[model samples]
Every structure is written in C-alpha cells, then in structure tokens.
Target: MVKYNLEPSESILIQSTGVCEGSGLMTAFTDELILTNMNIIHVSKGLFGNTKSVRKYPLNQVKIINGEAQASMGKSTNGIPNLQIYFTNGQLSFKFQSSAKKEIVKYVNGISKVLIGRESNLVANQFAIPGAEIVAETLKDTIGVFKGTLGIKSKGKAADEPVKATKKCIGCMSPLTGTKGQSIRCSYCDTDQIL
Candidate 1:
C-alpha cells in the first residue's frame, strides 16, 4: 500500500455505525476533527459510555466537527452493526462496536492509544474481543508494535528506484544517452557526435 503525507492542517474523520440491543435501527456516528497548533479538546465521560444524543468533543490539537453518539439495538439476531473509521492523514483508523459493552470500551481505549502515539498493551487489552486477540497477537509476532508488516518476499529496504531521463538529439530529435563530455550517442538511432 502507498502512504501519503498529510499536511498539518488536515482533518481526521471518523464515521462509525453499529446496532444497539433489542432495537432494529442502525445508529451511526460521523465526526470530523481538525488539528490545531496546541489546542486541547476534551470529551466528556458521557460522550462515549452512553448513547443518548449526538455529541461532539475535542482533544489536544484536534477538533470534533460532527458525531452521532448513539448505538442501535436490534430486536432480532441479524441486527449486529459494524463501525468504520477513516483517517485522512496516511493512517488507518479503527472504531469499536460490539454487543458486549465491556468489549466496546476496551476496543475504543486500545485504538485511542494507537491514534495518539502512545505505548500500547494492545494484546492484553484486546483479549476479550472474539478474534481481535488472535489478530493482535499475530501482528505482535510478525510486525511488533512500532514497525508495520512486510510481505513474505520483502526482505530489505523497499524504497522505490529513481527514474531518469535524457535529452534528445537536435538533428533527428531522437533520444540521446550519456553526457556532453562522456559520449554523444543516441540510443534510439545510430548517431554519434563526440564519443
């Protein structure tokens, strides 16, 4: 995957939707935050724990523009919801949504640390989730905490090779190789000037 750099003024957007309990409606949360120089945005406790109303909160150097802070409950078993979060700044974001309330909290807190660039005990923290513990443990073994995962064939540096181009001949307009002093030869045609 290709990674791009994000400008300092770029915004982070989180759009999360999940099903609540005993209700058939699917609830979603869409939030956008812009990072300032040194400002701090604090989210109240109720903003995450309870899904009463749509709320917006701010963290240090980040602002929340919009958020739908409610969970949807389903009357049937097919009412489970999946939440998705998108990070615009060359990084993928993760959101938490589960039938178990405790698992939801743990997933949120674990991913929050990763977003803020903090030390993580992600393995221990994600054990409660169904398959998250195995995935996290696999990641821990393969890529560790700081470094990202590499493919099986990728052994060393994965930097791309630089591209090069040369000038063309003024006479035939063909492509030329080498420099002025080294050799004046055109690779496209058999033309030599000052070899």
Candidate 2:
C-alpha cells in the first residue's frame, strides 16, 4: 500500500481516474490520516433516505477490510479492490496501489500553488472541473507530503450578501430579494409581476 501524508500547510491531488467507480465526476474529501471506507453510490444513491433509479452500474456499498478497499461497482458478487481514503485533523488524503501510472501531486502553503496550466495535460475532458483541476495539478509535483496539517488556498473573495432565494417573474432571472413589502416597483427587472 502506498501512502501520501498531507498536512494543514500543504495539499495533495491525485489522478482520480480509477479512484472512483462511476462515470460522472467523482471527488472525495476527509480530515486526514484516518482511513475511511466509502460507498461510491452513497452520495447520489440514497442509502439512508430514498433510493433513486438505478443507472448503468448498481453499486450499493464499499468498505475497507484489513488493508483492502472493496467496492461493488457492478453486478458482480465479488467486490473490486481500490485504495482506502484517509481522514483526520480536517485533512484528507488518497492512496492508490494500481498498475495505472496516474499521478498525484502534493502542495504546501508557502512552497507552491497548483499550476492550472499543467492540469490541462493530465485529467480527461469531463474530469476538468474548477476545483478538481486545481487538486490534480498539485499532486503532480508533490515534492514531499507534510504530516499533521493541511494547506488550503482561498478560491475567491467571499461576497457579503447572504444567499437568499429570489422569486423571479418566472420569465427573467432577476433579483427580488426585497420584493416582499411593495407591489409598487420591482426595481429589479422593472416587471410588475408579483409572486
């Protein structure tokens, strides 16, 4: 088993190609250090609440048993082997022990920033989301993994406005945050429509 230790002052991104079982985008997070078995379908499929329609693969659950991450990603009776996820101290790490030569990058606070331009080469077209791409590149050039801490970068400036629902005129997507008191003016789209 190959393990990469990460800390608060650093971040690691690994090629998630074979890490997740299903086809759509797959990303996982944990605190750090402690391994957690994951049920790949548990996120979208309702194991706790309600079950949705089954898709291409009907995986129900996964668990880490004695150094192996077993997953049921298909109709097979036997579980497939995969890496276990480590979580502790608000930090998350991934372990991969496969023949696939996919890369994982580790980054620390002052030492490096994920080069977005470099990620353009690694992940497939569909896997390229805003945050996922950043993680992928960071793991590519991980000089060393830090322990007991995690390094995080602020993505963007936080907006002061609290996110509230706006009742649009059912036509245009406009702000109606203050439309409750007055039916006189929309001041938004200028539409006289009332919710």
Candidate 3:
C-alpha cells in the first residue's frame, strides 16, 4: 500500500492494495487509489520516478464516476472491472484485472456513499448560505465607490448607466460581476469574454 499524506479532516474510505495501473492522455502510471471524504488521491512516484508523490482530485469538482464489467464469457473465474472518473480538469480510465473486480466494487460503493452525502449537504446549504454573488452583480449602476478607489471618474451625468445587476452570464444565466474596463468572466461555467 502506498502511503498518502492525508489532510486534517481527510479519512481513507478505501484503498486499492495490489497491482493497479492508471493510464490517460500521454501518461501511463501505476498508483494506488485512496478515496477519502474530501478527495480521491493517487499515490505514485514524482517527476524523476524516484520520490513518492500524490495527486488529489477534490470530490466537489468531480463530474462523474463509472464502473463497468469487462469480463469475458469463457473466462468465468477471472473478471475485469474498468473504473472511469471524470473531473473538471480531466478524466482517467483504469482497467483492473486479477483480484481487482472486488476491490473496484468496494471503491465504487464507497465513493457513491460519499457523493450522496455531499449532495444532501449541498441542498441543505442552498437555503442556509447567503447569496453573495447576487449582491455583487447589482453594483453596475453605482460606480462611484469604484471610481474613488481606482482614482478614475467622469463628469456629472455619466453617459453609461447599464445596471450590472441586470447582466447575466451568457452560459449559465447567473449574475455577473463586471468592471468598467475589464471583461466579465462567468464564474459558474468558466466562460471567458471572447468576441
């Protein structure tokens, strides 16, 4: 088992003990997957392949995780399990053989449980947390504060009077926080203002 440097509240839910390899993009690396409440950690070697290192994927940013069987009909004894994890940055596909089917099932179940719990928490927090993003969007008409802070201002009866509060992100329709000279980038969908 590859030892992982866990964070303060991070606790291991499952660990892939034996031979398991992860391959994606231009990289084929062997690492033990450690699933925690907060992250999915890959314990492997660093740049020189000598020192041990870890790559962590936060649970919130994960798009999806899927596991499917790759077993053949004739080979009844031996089963294969392929696990795929999708994230905002990238995704990884892992093919596990030998005694991996059982281990992969364990990992899938553990991750499902954690994800369900997080979803419920998010739903509950939706009502509790104040919407700070909404308030920031409504400040377009009132630019005096920004002018004073940035030391830039125009004469009385300013020509531009577009309400920033009314401006919504083109992708997600969420409210946007825009500066006068700077282009607005949507925080929700990560869309850059490119014309």
What is every candidate's alpha-carbon RMSD to the true fold?
Answer: 16.5, 22.9, 20.9
- Model 2 regions lying over 4 Å from their true place: 1-8, 21-79, 85-195
lDDT of 3 at 61: 69
Ranking by lDDT: 3, 1, 2
Clashing residue pairs found in predicted model 3: none
For candidate 3, what is the lDDT? 0.57
> Model 1, range 1-195, lDDT digits (tens) per residue?
112234487433322333222223443322222222222111212325542333223333221123311221112334332222223322122222444334344334433443454322332343457787789889756664345443334345543332344677766887665544555666656677652
Best by TM-score: 3
The lDDT for every candidate, in the order shown, is 0.36, 0.30, 0.57
Expressed as tens digits, the lDDT of each residue in 80-192 for candidate 2 is 22222222222122332243223232211101112111222212332347697678878744622432135543344543343444565544666565434345346655667
**Which model, 1 or 2, shows the larger TM-score?**
1
TM-score of 1: 0.21
Model 2 lDDT, residue 40, Cα = 17
What TM-scores do the predictions have?
0.21, 0.15, 0.43
Q: Runs in model 1 with CA error above 4 Å? A: 1-10, 19-54, 61-115, 126-195
Which tens-of-lDDT digit does each residue in 1-195 have in candidate 3?
Answer: 666778899898877633244433334344567789888777764444453667788877666433311111111122334555657777655544446555555555566567654222222332354866566666754676787788886665554664344466779888776554457678799986622
At residue 71, candidate 3 shows an lDDT of: 13
